[model samples]
Target: MPATLNQLGLPAVIVVGAIFIVWFVAGNELMRRRGRSLAIWSKRALDPLGGRQAIQWITLHSFRLEIEGLKPPFTSGNMTGLVESWDVPITWLINRLNGRRDMVLVQLALRQQPIRGIELFRPRSLLAGDARQLAVQEGWTTEPFEEFQLAAMPGATPQRLATELLAAIGPRRADLLRLALRRRGLHLTLALNIPNRQAVQPAELTGLLQGVAAVALRYATPAEATD
Candidate 1:
């Protein structure tokens, strides 16, 4: 071994190890705090929907939240949030550099259906490719909507449906990655990083969901009605 390397090795290693330990612990604590805040925020966001039961979990890089017992049209909702990558410095750096902020996968089940199928997506979202492919395979007609891609079951949905749905989303439309009307219910994917842990209002979310449901109901007509 070289004299200079051997001379300082053990002490240097100990110091480096201590720093790593501190970093890991601090990162974990930060994640825990964020998780708690999110849990509270989620409860508030779901309360108006009569969310009677809820479950939450915290992990190294994500938070999972689910709630049930919603009001009419919605039976349940679940959110899968990817927001705590800070526990791993490398991953955190990469995510930030890519302009990839945290996001939530929101799945909502409805008690009824307004239309057979529909999909709206922000074309720049990471999930855009998959949504597009699914639309094609399902034989849905696709069209452009400013910065979004809109698709609907050819004979099952109205041409004005897209306009109404976007209007329902209101000013927050830009943050939406995808809005789908499936056989069972609706799925909304939203980006939650920009406002960085900002508390979401229950009334606001409730309103958004209700507005979309209202539009869906308005378009629930026979296939020939769309023609």
Candidate 2:
């Protein structure tokens, strides 16, 4: 009886050990696969918007603008002006990533400059006609506007272009802009929740965000000063 029990025990131990090894290996591979998937998805999504190059530009030149109330004695300049400034940075990033630096020059001419306007209604004032119109125009159906303000800066420079870029990208990517601009620094954070939840993968989200940033920079410019 003793001999028989020993034989059974040895096989059982071996089997358990083998199972553990397999599980560990599989788990590690799964993690690696997930990471790679995320990256691929991100790149594919951002391809049209200009890829890594755009992201780099935003990382280097992006700045945070703070606003108070609806008035525009902006501590620096007009919000629109600030958007304009971002143009070169945005274009540089996108074009570089897309490997289309040559296209950047041509795109520059087509880009629109920032236009200063008064905020007729606060974002929170959904009841206001202007706010509602903005919402409709931007295709914002569910989210409420957090702030509503306007600026009337009159100039054409990098700053103005940056401001215009921000405005153009704001409606579609308000959440991203908010996160990127939440702090006063060059590094920006991107929320990968949407793509992640969809099981789209980390790489994919990164690529997509990078692309969007590039496009935003490419088309953004300050309104030509009417002075």
Candidate 3:
């Protein structure tokens, strides 16, 4: 009976190893597919704004998108976007445990500095500390606006700016976690809660871009905002 049990243990180990190998391969393949689909969806969604010149996959569930030569309405400069998804089972589990979810980040570096430095973000955000540090360094005042905290230099009119920006974002304001107008550019991070295998819509992306563009235009230096 002891000899028989030892012989069965070796077979059981082999079966378990095989199952793990299959799962690893299948899981990765699925993640890859989801990533590629996301890239396509993003490109299509951004078509009205500009053409996507490049896309690089950082991981099976993460990708970076580059849109060169942004069309009118968006100031000439660089627009970089990245999408991070939790499709892999292990990663999804880890992210869940950490109380984190999928997110999309977009950074637009304008050729001109249109607006004064300001940062607005929700409380307890990942970059809340950074905003605080920026406020202290620039001697900016910090205030609260609804569920978001606003930091801006004197005479920057934090209230007005927050109102305009939030209005531009519309109902989707809930998804917006951060919107900062830096010295030379804008940074936006939106919390994504996409269910199933669906992708974000074109109009949704368009709205966000238009909102940012509107802010940039409103504060443009006139001469510097041309073309």
When 1 and 2 are scored with TM-score, the better candidate is 1
The estimated TM-scores of all candidates read: 0.71, 0.30, 0.69
In candidate 2, how many Å is residue 139 off? 37
Best-matching candidate per TM-score: 1
Q: What range of 10 consecutive residues in model 3 has the weakest lDDT sum?
A: 76-85
Residues 1-227 of candidate 2 have per-residue lDDT tens digits of: 99999999999999988876776566455544544443334334433433122221222222222222211111111111011111343553563453221100001111232222211222332124543454355443423223423221233432343354345444334222222211122222233123132543334443444443453334345534666
RMSD of each: 5.3, 17.4, 4.7
lDDT of 3 by residue, 115-212 (tens): 56677776674456877887788778888878889888766466787788778777667566677776653433333333332445756867776777
Which candidate model has the greater TM-score, 2 or 3?
3
The candidate that achieves the highest lDDT relative to the unseen native structure: 1
What lDDT does each candidate get?
Answer: 0.67, 0.32, 0.63
Residue 180 lDDT in candidate 3? 73
| Clash total of candidate 3 | 0
Write down the worst ten-residue block by lDDT for model 2.
101-110
Error of 3 at 36 (Å): 2.0
* Candidate 1 weakest lDDT stretch, 10 residues: 186-195
- Backbone N/Cα/C clashes per model: 0, 41, 0
